[model samples]
Target: MPDPALLSIKDLHISVGSRPVIEGVSLDIAPGEMLGLVGESGCGKSVTALSIMRLLAEPPMHIDSGSIAFGGANVLDLDGPALEALRGDQIAMIFQEPMTSLNPVFTVGDQIAEVVTLHRAISREVAMARALELLGRVGIPTPDTALTRYPHQMSGGQRQRVMIAMALACDPQLLVADEPTTALDVTVQAQILDLLDDLRRETGMAVLLITHDLGVVSQYCDRVAVMYGGRIVEQAAASDLFAHPRHRYTEALLRTIPASNAPGTELPAIPGTVPPPGQRPSGCTFHPRCHAVVDACPRTMPELTGEPSSDSLLESRRMSLLELNHLSTTYPGAKGAVVQAVSDVSLDIAAGEVLGVVGESGCGKSTLGRTLLRLVEPSGGQILFDGKDLTALDRHQMKAVRRDLQVIFQDPFGSLNPRHSVGYIIGEPLIVHGVGDQASRDARVDELLALVGLPPDAGRRYPHEFSGGQRQRIAIARALALDPKLLVADEAVSALDVSIQSQIINLIAQLQKRLNLSILFISHDLSVIRHVSDRIAVMYLGRIVEIGPTETIMNKPQHPYTQALLSAIPRPGVARQKRVVLQGELPDPTKPPKGCAFHTRCPMVMDICHSVRPVLEHPTGSPTTGQVACHLYQDQA
Candidate 1:
């Protein structure tokens, strides 16, 4: 029998400049198994992957002591020439940002062919032919036509696919993928993920996937290694980690995920941010922000120990929400096309929920959010709010219903009128609804401002006078003015810094509990999505390809498109997905896919998939809330 473990990283100690980053870090990857190394940005996950390949820039990164053993040899000890031979021939890597990774002047096909030439003694013609074949395999459309195109000519997803083809050209035993899909669209993301899944199963090659998204690791990886600062704080089976997280950091990470089941309030985010490497505390690196931190946490760092495992989720994950018949709006083109943004798309939101919508520009996620609030004209489809059909209410008749509905838009600056002061901005809802008069509105605005943690005098400041975080607070306060039952946050906090992001997330979590408001939050940041969404709907060119409870969707995403979108989220560690480097921009929405919208660049495309549309239906092993539209899962055979 073959030894399952193919690569081992042991007691690695790495330092950059004058500070230590990775200390006593260790993990293993068996053949065909993926080990996800996850943490926030600037964590040591990237350094660890680079160290295995001996790629870190010297001086700043020095591996003082460590052992990276593969194929009975210590790769760390190998000299330049030996390491050079091992680099592309045995262990390969796909870095983040394909546009910059490739040589600007080289044709994409030539770049891939160059890798084949380096590892094997092959004629230029033969190598180029092999390059074309690999590109085709990676889902690049019209490989022959694309050979002459430079990296600049290809879209981000296409460029990434070229990078994958180059990495796979040598067929290395071990592959390290870093943020391979972060730049692609939701539909494209799903396709790339499915391709990675197919390739992993076929080659049985070990993959070290690095990312910040717990959802990605839960979906495509077998094992998980949680990172904090530069240390491996926890490691466990993917399912076990989700069901019963061991570390305090891991628990906090779980709470950060926004859930549709959670009423629209605030997300319980891990307080504070990842400290810069040099500023990391003396004892436990996570102590400053850990909610359960104790005195020992500030005095001694705890070793990662395996905890009791719960297999309940190992059998099957649970479903928390379901959307049956759904319809939204659409405006087809700049001219002739009728914009039926959302039509006949039924949706459901449940108890303890946070339902998320993800789509590229103009895919109707925002429109759908408005429709839920009856802010737009709905052409058709039943909307089940809890159990009631919300469309039945008449315009003036629904005035009472407006108190329960609230929305937060993408641009915090534009969303809040500049003419109004921060206090007035928030109190507008109270005044318009006649919930309170001048004195009462003033008092209520001050109360809401304090609830969001702003000072009482903040009411006197104009919208422009406050910072981005403060402006967002004003927006949140206004949304809360109605004391609503549901809220729709549309790209509400996309522009804030990472540290501020944590604060807002924490505030939202706190507010949700204080006021039970179901939220329809929408955004493009997958990292934020993994943390905030209880359930997610992946929209492509105006159709949801996959929808399910967050954990279920993250753990076993069925649609290739959903898989690709999840795979694209960037994290600090765990190698990235290789083959699913989706190679095309979203098809022009005006002229969508003839059948399956994703088929144009799908890796596992079938002839039938092009001729017939796949229905969004339930799969047997999926959670009840999970709905996917893909030919791969169909019972056609």
Candidate 2:
């Protein structure tokens, strides 16, 4: 016999100011089970999770219908005192961003202990002791010292651990984790997910994990529920859902993932964006973008039913356009120490080729990009673009050279001026470079906007008037205004939703091919990197660990760090691979390890790795025409 459901939601209907948000949604989470609720942004995943705990604000948000029952008690009907007791006691939540959720004025210990003291009648000292135990359990290093530090003092991974510890303080029967690892690095994300799985087994608690990442859902959850505009489109066991997805929306969503497509090929992006809440089409909300849509799809919403569905060579003959010869960047740290952000990295990109730089945070990929563009002055080595030494150029000379180099940042809105119209934002580069008069520049702006798939009339609107994907398109138009030869995109698509991300990615790829442009694509996501890049360079602690053709690196990575990164990525519709979990967090940049910076956490580290740094070279018996820096290859060579 199976256990009864710990939390049950039946035909939930949520509304914001008479507009429907979540409609006819039902889900169940049994004790000791992990269920994943997935959908794009504004699809009511979070609202459903919030309603489970009565966390939604009233007036603006109201439950139009349905019931959420936890352990035979109706959560929506609970009074103030009962609701307070229900929260953080039998049911707990870990929000998306821990920095915003944690109190800035309080220490880690004080914040965690408050949860304990509020839920249980425990002394402050005992609560603090329990907090320490949780910190340790969640894999935080030096828990005794961490308890006294502020949220900002610790790294992102450590801060997330603190949030997890606080959620587990009361030993809740159910845990609601909402996009908890979305902003984390791949390795850190793996660690957090593994920790949750272990804790679930030990505590026998159910988890409702809400995210848009199908990969994470496939790897972690036992049961999966697919959410579309305000409704449950499909629900099944995780394996069954991935192997035999019946919903057209689910099938299209899977197609958008880069892993499901080939390298340097156009991704089959879903046509339109998710419609806004009061403006959704009559019948199926996804019908507008569905390739297999029928006349009936636009008039009738489908019922939830059981379904089954299916889902760069760097070393070539071309001349190099951009070359980095032992480029380095350093900044002064506390106590007169120098932080090596980019260390002795060397690489080249050919004309019309896309070179991807990938690694965890603080691995110097962004720094390398900025340094090569002269945005951040290099500390050593040379940047050669088209046979000209960028490092030796004067300020006036570099200013002229800027016409050929441009960059697109992660936050499109942050880079764009909210006060300016789209026309002015895109034409300002032409104006600054004195490429043409006002009329000609205005004409160029319209052409550029059209090139990026936006209409000429979109120029009159401001940045805030557009969606996230539209804003990114505007940024791309601005970056291409000068017709630059080299484009540096730094984490450009990391912030958008999955469907929107696919749109932007396909746009960039098309532009790259159409314009014959060379791009330096920097991101932490290997899957995205694989799709757009001809070649890849893996970085760790300011050094390139491996460089190779896209297929070679993905299929047969030589370096341990590269292998671990590849293993950490969650693959939809594929069985979970044995992850090469690195031991500890990244080391201090100001005071890196004596020899190899990765030696401390590498799974295949040897005695020589502690004293001698390995040179980047091709390993014996390997089929890749790539270079790797590791003693495992060096010893074999």
Best by TM-score: 2
Every candidate's lDDT = 0.75, 0.87
TM-score of each: 0.49, 0.51
- Please, what are the lDDT tens digits per residue for candidate 1 over residues 1-637? 3353578878999888778888888777777777778888877888999988999898767989989889879988899899988988799998878887899988887888888888799999999999889889999999999998999998888887887788888888888988777678867767776777777788877788888777777889877888889898877778857875656777788787765228887888777888876889888898899776544457666555321122211222211122336675655477786665664565555433467888666666778788777787677776555345667878775777676678877668888888878877888877777885788678777778778999999888888888888788888988888766577888877888888888887788666644434567788765676677777887776788888878777888887877777777766787765535667887766666687878887777899788788888886554465888888777872
Which segments of candidate 1 are over 4 A away from where they belong? 1-4, 260-263, 307-637
Residue 278 in candidate 2 has what lDDT? 92
Residues 202-274, candidate 2, lDDT per residue (tens digit)? 9998899998888998899987888888998877677756764657788888888888899999998878777
What lDDT does candidate 1 reach at residue 541? Answer: 66
lDDT, model 2? 0.87
